[model samples]
Target: MDKNIVFLLNFKINKASSSRKRGSRLIQNLDSRLRGNDKRVKVKKRKKFVLLSLVFNYILFVIYRLSYAAKYLIN
Candidate 1:
């Protein structure tokens, strides 16, 4: 009877550990997939920000040139 109890306990422990390993593997896969998507989104956002900044700078430069021309005219 004692041997049977020992065998049952061992089996239960092994089963529980295998399930835990599977769970951890699933989580790892999900995390990697999310990270891949996040990187793509970050790259797209960075490109948009660079384009916007360039446009904004061009507008500012045009305004400055216009103001300079006006000053010259007034003088």
Candidate 2:
């Protein structure tokens, strides 16, 4: 392990915790940017879920149409 890196990280962690009130969150006190990123990540996940549902529904519809066409042809 690099001594310099460990020292720098420790210094930062100590500095952040020292500045905040007792019993408050330590890491989150550093910045609100992380909170915003969490929201963006959640929204992206929601969009991906919506897209997957749409594709699944479309596939089911296609199968249904094919089955209906085959039944009519048989008759």
Q: Number of the top candidate by lDDT?
A: 1
lDDT of 2 by residue, 1-75 (tens): 468755755666787675566324444432333345565578899999999999999999999999999999999
Residue range 1-75, candidate 1, lDDT tens digits: 368755755565565566887656555554555456655677899999999999999999999999999999999
Please estimate how well model 1 matches the true structure, expressed as its whole-model Cα lDDT.
0.73
Which 10 residues in a row give candidate 2 its minimum summed lDDT? 23-32
Steric clashes per prediction: 0, 0
How does residue 18 of candidate 1 score in lDDT? Answer: 62
Score residue 15 of candidate 2 by CA lDDT.
71
In candidate 1, what residue range of length 10 has the lowest lDDT sum?
A: 26-35
Off by over 4 Å in 1: 1-37
TM-score of each: 0.53, 0.53
